[model samples]
Target chain A: MVAPVAVVGALFIVYPLVKLTMDAFTQGDGGFSNFAAVFESAAIRNSLVNTIVMSLVVTVLCVVMGASISWSIARARSAAFKALLWAALLLPFWMGVVVKAYAWSIIFAKNGILNSVLDQAGVIDEPMTLLYTRLAVVVGMTYTMLPYAVLAMNPTMSRFEPEFLNSARSLGSSRTAAMVRVWLPIVAPGLIAAAAIVFAISIGFYVTPVLLGGAETPFMATMIGDDIFAFFNYPRAAASSVLLLVLALVVLGTALKAVGSKALKGGIAG
Target chain B: MTHPPRKLLAAAACALALTASACGSDTDSGSGSDGSVKLTIASWGDPFTSATREHLVKPFTEETGYEVDIVDAPGKFVANLEAQTQANNVEWDLLDSTSGPDAYIAHDRGLIATMPDDVKERLLEELPEDAVTDFGISWSVLGYVGACNAEAVDTCPTDTAGLFDTEEFPGSRTSISTSPLVNLSMAEIANGVTIDELPTHEIDLDRAFETLTEFQDASGAWWSSGDQNLQVFESGEAELGISYSGRAYGLIDSGTPVEVIWQDGLYNPGFWNVTEGSDNPDEAWEFVEWIASHPENAAAWAEALGYSVPNPESFDFIDEKTAKTLADFPENREKLGLMNYAWYVENYEEVNKRWQEFLRG
Candidate 1:
């Protein structure tokens, strides 16, 4: 049953991908024209760079923050505290993306709750421009990815022997040094897998960037969407989609090699 | 209270089949029982679809004894219809709430069935002459006008040109960020281009872009969808922006402090058309006429939906306070300029590329 299902799934994927590849090349003026258009236009190139840079930022934020949350949950002495940490990490998973984006809009609005709180606290004289900016996009994207990153890293972090830290410290090493030398290597696989997941997921983000970042902050996903929906340029959309797919595959492939497929799968499931 | 395993499985299968609307409703519905013919019309989705279903579909189904299912296609109506037409299996019987140029494009491409002389005569009796086309009948009106969050800003732009007067108005402005036509055409008016010069909504690209860049500079939180339009205003992401009359008025009803300005506002008619190879053309056309003739129902719908009915008689049933807010109110109509979407559709490629570039900037 599984073998047949796998074959049918692979066939479904292969057929569409083959058609899309043909359309990408043949639908443009000629071979590679769609790709030429991608490189030729400064706007498309800008979106490509923006998507990459934004994903990088979101990934870094997710990793550092994810690690801290995972460590806290693992190191918690009380069951209630561990559960609390777990609950907080899983909070975003409960809400739909569009709802989260709208909620962020309310919080980041000019006269919104954040501004009101800041004003009451006398933090600033005027409301800063928060909504519809690159910064807002980063904040929203990172908030979404942090939960997944934590989930990915939690297993590896939690399973580690706590006595190793004491043993390293007792062996005449400083706390920071022991952490750097021992703890780093032990959890590096999960961290790498989490980062890969966050980065890949961030690349495909569509709604948050549009709602929070507005038209000015169009991501690569937004660009492809415009080609398909707004402009109805299927070839260009296909080309961009192909490029994005390749980018995602390359990232995942690099991570899988580093962590090994089994370890990476185990890390994610945990 | 639990059923036996076999009984439960049968019930679950029945539920699944009913929920999947396309299961066999596609082919067999044409000859369904009760002699109440089933017709499917492609709709642009809520809140337009909500209003259409309430005022038009429900009454038509009750009066004429025909069944109607609304499919929300949004901007993909023409494209999807074209695909189905090519496949020799045209699914939708009617294309409801098609924008003005979309009707023209579909008609020009021979995608929609031409209005038979008899149907034309019936439609013309209820709707005006200009409103009745060979391929489409004008069903409703849409206005893209300047609107302000009344509580947010001290001043508002009275005319389209004043929208560019950032220092005088003194607030973050926003507008439709997706289409070049809305911003660019309005910008042309702001840049001193007249309706006479731009009868087809064509823009002097150089002049329009300058004003557009200025407008972009002054604006914050530009919107792409109707929900975003309300979101920006409700959250104060924008102080004043170009907003649809329906949404802006709906905001007022919902107790959001939105003030719509009609002077130099852009307007367009929404069309109702029958697809070329529709399963039930007569039923679809009958539904169209039903909507066109019933002014009171139109009025009630407009009251509920905050859009204008094409029929002038709708105003009589509509309350004075509500009438002022409708898109086709004489006073508001006088101040509004009809958008020339034919020009926009003709130059869609250039305009869309320019729009993408402009937004990226």
Candidate 2:
């Protein structure tokens, strides 16, 4: 049983990674020409830059949005409020990412739900082109990443003691002050975790970005996919995949370090 | 140490499961040995696939006594081909694709084997030098024509220039959504410059941007899927839009009041290529010859799939209305432009750079 499991693991995960890495370094007609081309091309660089920018924007948005939403759920005074929060958070999780992106697209399209509603309500004069813009991509990515953040923060948020806020309030600390100084510090690690997840997912996302973004807004993962499948250049695609893994690792390392620093400050880690 | 090793083992097992799942899909098997060659032919998505199988494959099987196995190539054609090629595994025998950079890449990689000798000879005799390539033949011509909801726009824009003239035709429009190919070409044409006369070495990047800006201002949204185009026409999402003629037929079939104008449409042939070093070359070649030859087969293919066939004679096989609707008719055929695919292949890196820069702004 153990041997079979080990063999399966090695064949799938280990072999592919090893094969991909070997392929990336290979140079020839069917080889590193793609990687060389990727490096030489300005489009790839622009896409990489766009991907990073979009990922950062989404991570920031998720942190702020996730923290606020989770805080309300955490501080809910009634069962109904908690139920509502859970319903909202879990509802998105049940829906497919592609389905959600399509829903957002329909709402954001020129003759989409938003424009139609707006038109009926007399809010705007005409429809706006919201489907194939960076703004649309950001919205889509943020929506996809929202549940991860919410789920991550939920447990930590619920664990947060109301007595800490009460103590701060008793000491004449305003509600905002208590949240900023007391509550934020305790939830900071979870917030960092949520941000990291959102950032990592955003950097490598394809579906939402491809559907919602313009040609210029190609993410690194999508570019790698294009190289392997669209371009039929495996060596280059492999190289790009390796690069993506590296980028992801660097991001994860930075996030870990940040979390470690917070843990040390809070005396959670020695 | 025990706990860490257990966790590592678990992680490793999960990774293996994913890899196994990916590899399980790529397997090559011929039809049961009854002297009937079972060839797996792959194309893009549905209605087209179903139509082609219905109209062409079924009739071919009925006549030839060879079983036709039609499959939708996973994801896009190039990616599916790449994965198979990368593993040195050839599950797909015949593939339907246009002469794009990947075809060139595949040819370079020695992934495409020889076509049937007679098919090659026929192509050389019939197709112009620009039509055929070493790797694949011109299967069907892809074009971007001005299709309109007949109810909204009384006159479909006749040419590429008139497409951007929003004031004259006041309604939403869509072009080939993702690929910047048509967009760049149209921009040059709209800018009063022909692509043939433009500097071969250096593409005017500024003109591309200027063209897209005009399109973005005038158009509703960039369409990404065939379904999106179907919805656009069906729901009257756009008054006039550029789409694959095949997709437009789907709308018309569903009783959408949409019509096409093939004037100045970019037409390129979709090609069929066999995987190099396949164990079943004879079987594959047999399937290819059956598909490419026989106007009836091609006509049934076009009728079933809603896509236009390269066989000029196939038009006669379909109904009069359907025949007129084909992208390669005399009224439309003359205006159907061909891009120097070889030029695009060689300078893809440069073209992509300019395309990205243009899109960013």
Candidate 3:
């Protein structure tokens, strides 16, 4: 049984990855020129920077917002309320990514609901520029990845002992102090897991940024797509893909190591 | 322990089956035992395929007892054709393409079949010489025109130059970012050059980008898709934009208070070409011939699509008011400029790199 599973894995996953790496090295007159070209191209460089920046921003936002929601849901007394919260959190995941991106575009449009509401409320004389900005890209990405963060952190938050917070409070800790000194440390493993997953997913975001963002919001995945479909430069696309994979793996591995596997496993198991 | 060995055997058998399936080809021989012919035509998908099936395919199948299958062929047309040809298992009998350097490239690579002499003569007589190549025949034309929300602006842009003149007509503007052809061409026009001079005048990238940067600063969005263009206007993101005439017309028809300027418009035509090594070349030729001969069919198609057929006879079938909005209308045709596809194909890689840099900047 192990032999068959290994054979399948080798044929599909390992073979493609090896072929891609070889193609990246050998295509376009061979050598590491493809990697060189990736670094040299200003467009690709900008996309690289943008991808890293956007992913980091999105990960931070998802953690903050997702942790708050998860904590609230976990502490809620009503099962009905908890169920509703879970449904709301998982709703976006149920929808297609492209559809969600387009929906965000509508909501963020100049005359969209947000602007229209703001305008009617006398909040501003002119419509705010909501769509086609880095802010919009981050917002869309966070919305899409928030569910994963919530799902990751919810289990841990539910299993969290209120005694820790009470004990911190008994030791002369304020609410904020209790949260920072006790609750946060106790939930640190889940937070790290959530951040790792969000960052990994956000780094490869293609549709959200494109549909909701402006020209300045081009991400690494979009560049890879353009390289393959528009430019038909497979070698460059492969090189970029490999770089993206390495970046994601490094970040995820570092986060997992920092959190400690025992803590992570405990958090998940709980 | 016994279960492990059985599972391993099952897995191995499954892997072998998957490998065998992957190596198999999806080839369909044209001839049936009952002597009927079946041909597969690659399409760009609905509603083009849907319209073609309803108007063209159904009629052809009824008139001639041949089964024609319309399959979705979305991206990298030439690459797919080459791969199939190399494998000696060509699946498609015909391919619908935009009449441009791509069709010529396919012809050069011997991926598309050459038109018979009589068919070629008919297409030449109907369409402009440039529109009908030996390997392809122009079916319909779509125009890129200046579009504006009429309700928002008192004075509409009469030509492409007015789109860049923000001082006179102030408000947000948008254009496509994926292809540089329309934007660069319009920029050239805005810089006091006519479409006629574009063939000889080397495209000045610096000048184009300078103007484009100014426009981008003044514009609210840079759309990448047709749906986005419509959204830009409908949602009031941009007061003015350059978009396909069909999209602009759709907006007008939907009561968006938008107008499409036909003057100095850029036009791109669609083509119908038979693929090389088709199992039913004779039936494919017959289908192409039927499409060319029936202008009414093309007109119905163009009307449904909000575009124009290359066959001028199509006008007789469509209403007069609708005909006036078409790309190939006599009045609009005079003001229209055809994109230099040959130049684009030759310089696309370099031009696109610069275009990407400009877009990023």
Model 1 spans with C-alpha error above 4 angstroms: A11-15, A28-30, B1-37, B108-110, B195-198, B254-256
Judge candidate 2 at residue B60 and give its lDDT. 71
What fraction of the native interface does candidate 1 get right in terms of contacts? 0.47
Residues A1-270, candidate 3: write the lDDT tens digits: 999999989998799899898989898867889999889789999999999998999999999998899888877777677667766766676667778888888898898989999999999899988899898899889998897787666656767888899898998999999999889887888899888878987898888888899655799988897776566677898999989988998987897889877545543332
Task: Estimate TM-scores for all models.
Answer: 0.90, 0.80, 0.89
Colliding pairs, model 2: A229-B79, B51-B304, B51-B305, B139-B270, B140-B270
Q: Is candidate 2 or candidate 3 better by DockQ?
A: 2
Clashing pairs in 1: none
Q: The CA-based lDDT of model 3 is what?
A: 0.80
**Of candidates 2 and 1, the better by DockQ:** 1
Model 2 per-residue lDDT tens digits across residues A156-242:
666788899999999999999999999999878778777776677678888888777744467887677655554455566677777
- lDDT head-to-head 1 vs 2, winner: 1
Residues B142-248, model 1: lDDT tens digits: 78888887788887778777777787887888888776777887888777766545556566777888888888788877889888888778777788879888888
Backbone N/Cα/C clashes per model? 0, 5, 0
For B76-154, candidate 2 gives per-residue lDDT tens digits of 5666665667677767777766345456656655777756666677666644455556666666666667677877776
Q: How well does candidate 3 score on lDDT at residue B28? A: 48
